[model samples]
Target: MTTTSHSNRDLRDEIRDYWSDRAATFDNDPGHKISAGAELFAWANLFRRHLGAANGRSLLDLASGTGEIALLCKELGFAVTGLDWAEPMLERARSKAPEVTFLQADAERTMLPDASFDVIVTRHLVWTLIDPKAAFAEWRRLLKPGGKILIVDGDFVSRNWLTRMIERFSGSTSHGMVSRHQDIVARVYFNRGARSEAVASLLLEAGFENLRIDNRLSAIHRAQAHLFSWRKSLLRRSEHRYAISASAPMTTKE
Candidate 1:
């Protein structure tokens, strides 16, 4: 988690406060929470496809608000650690899954030990990063040699006409916090949103390889569709969302 400053206060503080305020009701949104259902199975299936079997592998979930993804991975036999900047979100996460080691830390420079995890994962986090390249570099440093990273993100700002209309008709809303989205957007790297190609470039620059993209994100959308109205479901499924996976290079022992 990071922030931008204005009027003597940084965007970091603003974002932290905003998410903390929303922490209580965060799971109310369909995509935000994964309970027992087809949606949960869909996520498990997707992770299995990209990550193979968990097999007690150590995994880190960056920006792990409420720890849902961490818990899912844990259920799949991962030694999961959930990291976030918001304590309120971590608190909720802790209540649900005490076994996970939840840390309140910055995602960009976690300062955790090197070669600490076999896999790293995040969702909807890249677009908000002020220094995504730095974050990617840090993530690479954190992973063991030949480890993998799974990024679930999108260019949330740039939308087609149909998406715009659907969003407008759906009247989508955030956590009811003051609408500082544009203000934060102005300071972040991906103001238009974290498109796959742009992010792939960053990953390559950061020394990650084997870049793979999940264009449809069909499994997630299909699972979440029933939770919303028809308009909202269409909007969700039709959005330009995606997932990307990249690998840290293998190193030979000296």
Candidate 2:
């Protein structure tokens, strides 16, 4: 194989292994699981408000760690499929939501047929990608005409004062494995440049239209001072950590 191909393969393996190692404790992280009714309601409302009604829609949750979003979508009556490369993570997801379809696949190059989904959603996944541009193209290809792609991610490498303060009071902590994985991912090309503006440009370059970014989710996160503090603490070791939602349009075929 060519050097570039080999390098990409190595990177993918590194990422997959990183996540596999963390799968056991992935949901144990306070920020990773939604245990409270109010939080679940908030998240459901957030998805509904952004993606519209989920019922009868075919939703693909890319990088669906532990099936969090996929389960939620299924609960809302959507035909949900969760895809991830890490087997351990998929195992957790399958255990949690056996009713939903879970597949082990790379987000950048899913083996599923084209134009198969009405909506694609992902959270905290972009930063872990090696080639987000390629992933966007694949996502667009998988999306049916007029379908939407909802991405929830943030720059964890550049923290502001307010975020730091929140971390201080929240007493949030991270495991060694999580920190190591974050550091490794932070060095990747897309993760290194994971700012909202940069990602928006990528979406446009990938042939998406009607692009929009809603930072209100970030505002909501900041507003929930207690939760935000805990979340911030877990992520404080990583740089460029800030969350936002980005959506874009896909033209319907004639």
lDDT by residue for model 2 (1-254), tens: 59888988888888888899889988876657765576677677778877888768999999998988898889888999999999999999999999998999999899899889988998888877888888899888898877888887778655677757666676425667657777777757765447888888888898777677766554334333355444554454344433334344545559
User: What does the lDDT read for residue 139 in candidate 1?
Assistant: 98
Candidate 1 lDDT over 99-141, as tens digits, reads 9999998888788999999999998899898788889999999
RMSD of 1: 2.8
Model 1 residue pairs with clashes: 3-11, 3-12, 4-10, 4-11, 4-12, 5-10
Query: Cα lDDT of model 1 overall?
Result: 0.87
Superposed by TM-score, candidate 2 places the C-alpha of residue 191 at a distance from the truth, in angstroms, of 3.7
Q: Each candidate: what lDDT?
A: 0.87, 0.77
Global CA lDDT computed for model 2: 0.77
